[model samples]
Target: MKKLLLIGFMLFQYMSFAQEHAWVYLTDKENVATSIANPISILTQNAIERKATHSIPIDERDVPVNENYISQLKVQTGITVMAKSKWFNAVYVIGLETDNISVLADLDFVASIDFADKSLNSESRVALSNNKFEIEESLIDFEYGSALNQVEMIGVDHLHVSDYTGEGIVIAVLDAGFPNVNTMDAFQRLRDNDDLLGGYDFVDRNDDVFEFTGNEHGTRVLSDMAGFIQDEFVGTAPDASYYLFRTEDSAGEMPVEESYWVEAAERADSLGVHIINSSLGYRVFENENYSYTPSDMDGNTAFITKGANIANEKGILVVNSAGNSGGNEWQIVGAPADASGVFSIGAVDFEGNYAPFSSQGNASQPTQKPDVVARGAAAAVVNSSNVIINNSGTSFSSPIMAGAIASLWQALPDATNEEIKQFVRMSASQFNTPDFFLGFGIPNFELALEIGLSLAEEEFVRFKVFPNPVSNILNIQIPTSAEPTNLKIYNVLGKLVLEKNIIQSETKLDLSLMASGVYMMSFESNKGSKTFKLIKS
Candidate 1:
């Protein structure tokens, strides 16, 4: 009796601190208009017929609601499912134990599920290997490709790649199976740069994710992050390090696969990985009954997603694919990718226009999904076999952005994840006014890094705005040695809140009637125009 009581007490403590998770809803098959445009719809209806849709919580607000759905959802699946989100055509759910999700699949109504475990498989992707360097050299078509040689070849206007590469940062790529990675010439760069950190094959539970054919997912992704650049195609972060972990199996999308992902994430975290780039997402699976509802978009649903969120909290920046099939029945984005802390990258063309195939979202429940966009259309990357192939999907876009993010982290070591995220969002081409299609818009890598560093430096300056979260009287205590050139403030709506030119040592402004929220302040010192985030209480 005493032992049982202690165990129960421990369970209670865990429940108290543990985060909530649920399966949530995406879209009902009944609601989907058609899928000739969306061949994926067949998968959804299959799930619905299998009671997979019923396995997901029913729409509480629907005309003929399944009154037993909510209670049964909690009792049967042991998770919470909230209301549906029209913006993303999904529902929100919250739960505790993210692992051992097989119990859900065993349920009569359930089809597929995700682990709710918060453990992450995150770690540094920087491991020096002869093979990694070789891939880098071979991809660039260089007799010998050094970091410097690759940099000189890329054709971007102003890429801050050197500062990042010189620092030697690592980025982990989590995706489907990678075939023939060992023999791939494209991987020589990863080997040469000493950036190919080891990874796990969660798909097959083996060390190799490339044992299968037709799955170049991992190979293409890793190449984008640390691929060697020649004339026409250049990766965003060619000099950075890389780690490859395969979480998806070639068979199809499923809950077991996500369990594998969670396990992988935990391993990554244990290795001290700095960043995780996951290009896999799930809405509908082979077991249609397990298709995700919008409510399941919360970070707490799948263990892998929970792990992804934890990765961010631990200072590891997490990036995920927004999902393809934009012009489909399940028009919203998919799970684990929808986790709040993770920065989901959407697909865009070279022109930075939103790709129609890019998944749409205001997130499943709330907050922004696909926090930013990157070039995904016709993304060029070297396959393991030394062949150059251009692929299209949010999957490719995610890794491209991940490379850029790794570069930024190398440049700004002291910066926090929030600082990095906000800086990237604010410096984007379409910032302030975000939408379902494009959250904050496309990030400018160089500009974002500059903004982040400037803010960190400025924070140390005498610019102390006392009573932050203030109702009025915003005071700026300027640094004695700094010269004030032009100061501007933009409201959350991107409206110019206030602007002034001052050469004085101190600055003060009054905001008696502005609605309270978050604001952006740009202070132009002779040095540079620095941007900072302000929250109004």
Candidate 2:
């Protein structure tokens, strides 16, 4: 009996030191009213301004997690507080999966507990997965050098020529590490301009993102956006400001990194970051118990995906890399990239052909997984040693696309996040017929700008059109005091299909004979000309 008792004691000790991870969700903040009333105390001035511009309300989620509850949890035996997320009203804790973590649920203030290890929990919970930082280095013009194809592919070169190079936009880069950005000559211009704002290392919980030399994935990723060498290499958004955060642990893959990522994202949102470019994708972890099934990639299942959607709700454009898992067993895009609000980017060759190595979208998803593609194969980027090199992956493609988006957003600063996404999607090569491989294919920023301008003009037009997808008849409502209006309809090929002149307040046009496709209608009068996009069904 004593031998059996000793064996039982040993097993208990083993379980105690397992060092399992879990999130302890709290019941309430207790200071929600006060924090919501004074958002400035919690959020930065820029963040408050962004919310006001987007009309997002300051709620309890904006309130910081109650420190008292955290302090209470810290005193518990065999438990260590790792990270706190106000957005989820929870704190990530590390302890024994059985006793220490489960005991937390007994506390009145503790609402529930979720274990990272799915089998450990009595209740069902999501198991997160993460991709290791990997890249395919391949061995890119004059002013743009080798970067010309990437820049011009998405029609951002025209915006650059017009001096709209992401001057006032702010982008946050969350990745593994930035080794030599502080000392690299390729980033000297960025430093001289003081556009490198700030950053944090959530893995080590420090601000020394460039202090480590273990992984340089982030260095290459940032080079696609902020790196500028006079007339040698230019990033997509050379003039944009940046905040670099190291959220991925280069030494290992763990679910804890997802919590770290959420912490970094919260900080980015507080700083009023306009865009988030995460070249890192998560789908599988070092521990098989935490691996995610393909069905879990439904945009809301993964923890990171949930946080990403919340980030979007806060009015930030989140861009992620569609994982490099193509032609493999797990071929679909990973979490956060699977998020509906995230602009997941895929890779394409210089010839506008889809890169087979780029991950594809799953048809079972609620929305398209990869919203667009950019040049990733043989893409030009600056390494940590200040050397311009070619790298291939959706990693490079995402930053390349993100930098261009910053420039596009700079041009239409008043446009909402949804509006910006709409314009870009509408300008893609395969907008009308997207496929699983390349989703919407590629976008043309030049055409996107034209679309935005045209829609802005339509807002002031005196005519109103209804039944946008009209089958047989189209109705146009003109002001009672309007002059004679001339209407012209054009097909997708820019060829005139129909034309008419109308003086009535309400005019109906017959279109039963028109082919079923997309068309544009233009109205001309003494005041000005207005254009409306129409779909003939």
Candidate 3:
């Protein structure tokens, strides 16, 4: 009887301390003196460069949260700060039982106080396990070893042969944690060449992401893109640079992780990342009331989805994993995947059939989700121990598709993110008849490049140049149907080297004086103008 009484007392104590988390929304950035006029003061130089290239403006959203307001909130003894979102103009905090959170609503800076966790019941706060999906390892023999099937399935090798290996692209990977990426032999090339730019641990509020002892899910996801072992395994975008961020906490499931993801994405945008690959998704939360239903899967709903859309507007191609809930009762693609602008990926087998575990798109949503499918079942990956292995999940598929997209973007550096996405969709096998399981089917990089080139030709006047690597003379050929136009040749730096009038369909120019390098040729006809890359040998 005494033991039962003690148990009851402990339960009561537990309930007393389990107060709900809340977000204090500030009315405005009033107290903050930071100005939006000078984005360089807040954003990095790379970030500035991206904005300049993409013609994206430095707006009010780019400014940091008011430090004075946050500092004042920190002074409160009973509140523990969780995360701050500059995008939402809000700060998430956890209050103790003795704290009077209602008093915060009276503060001049405070807009409103809302509970982060809607459900306060202890039983509804149980953490969800991460072992819902099982990985199946398969052994395959090919010239490229473990990576051969996956890369070849998507035709990324063709881009590699054309020397489009995502050399200058920057990709930011947001995941649970990278356990052994720093020391793994498979990533030796990336480390030696400084391709691994840097990373941060948002959960711990530290910069030591490499040393963090967390799950290997991130390591596996990264392996599909950057891992390389000479003649053993070659990732899709082996030359692309990367920023690793730990946004998800593997030990627990909660809405706070969504805030962490948004924070990481904002950091990525500020770092001028060209692409973001997020394999994490949110659906069920520890607090049942915070969980999303199928109807909430609409693109505009969840916080992460909204954040992803904002990231897309900033010119970063966001690739996310369609949740792996197909076999379960709540079988539908989760949050950010439902977000319109994101390039969500699904899982497929080697035979081009949808993986049973791959989640389908939300039927109610108008947009066909899981933008495309990749070889996720028994997908090749290098483990944390530097050994090549096979794993299965949309997580692996998302990175595989992301790397290929990067390589494709490298081939068409002048194309906008939307153009690239459209070309990729057009190159899919089932583009015209997209289904829920595999939206546009598998994408072919070779075909995507061809489609992009064709679209460019249509947008601009079509012309041909010969003896591209010419040593003495270069030949220009305009279609007989085309009108005579002025032809100009510029160096890679956009400096005009020569200009001539093309009166006839066939024209020749002496180039013996030019040095050996790459150049751009532009033909300005009455109809339109076109520019093509030229090689001078």
Off by over 4 Å in 1: 1-157, 229-233, 298-300, 458-474, 477-520, 523-529, 533-537
User: On a 0 to 100 scale, what is the lDDT of residue 396 in model 2?
Assistant: 94
Error of 3 at 69 (Å): 1.1
Ten contiguous residues with the weakest lDDT in model 2: 122-131
Q: How accurate is candidate 3 locally (lDDT)?
A: 0.80
Name the better of 1 and 3 by TM-score: 3
Off by over 4 Å in 3: 1-17, 30-34, 97-100, 119-144, 458-537
Query: TM-score of the candidate numbered 1?
Result: 0.63
In order, the Cα lDDT scores of the candidates are: 0.60, 0.84, 0.80
lDDT score for residue 80 of model 3: 72
Stretches > 4 Å off in candidate 2: 1-17, 122-130, 139-144, 458-463, 466-537
Cα lDDT, model 2, residue 452: 70
lDDT of 3 by residue, 37-87 (tens): 666677899999888887788776777778898998888767777888887
**Model 1 / residue 349 / CA error / Å:** 1.6
Give lDDT tens digits, candidate 1, residues 439-521: 77877766777677666654445467667777888777666635756777775434466778877776667777767876777
User: How much is the lDDT of residue 173 in candidate 2?
Assistant: 97
**Of the candidates shown, which would achieve the greatest TM-score relative to the real structure?**
2
Candidate order by decreasing TM-score: 2, 3, 1
Better of 1 and 3 by lDDT: 3
Q: What lDDT would candidate 2 get against the real structure?
A: 0.84
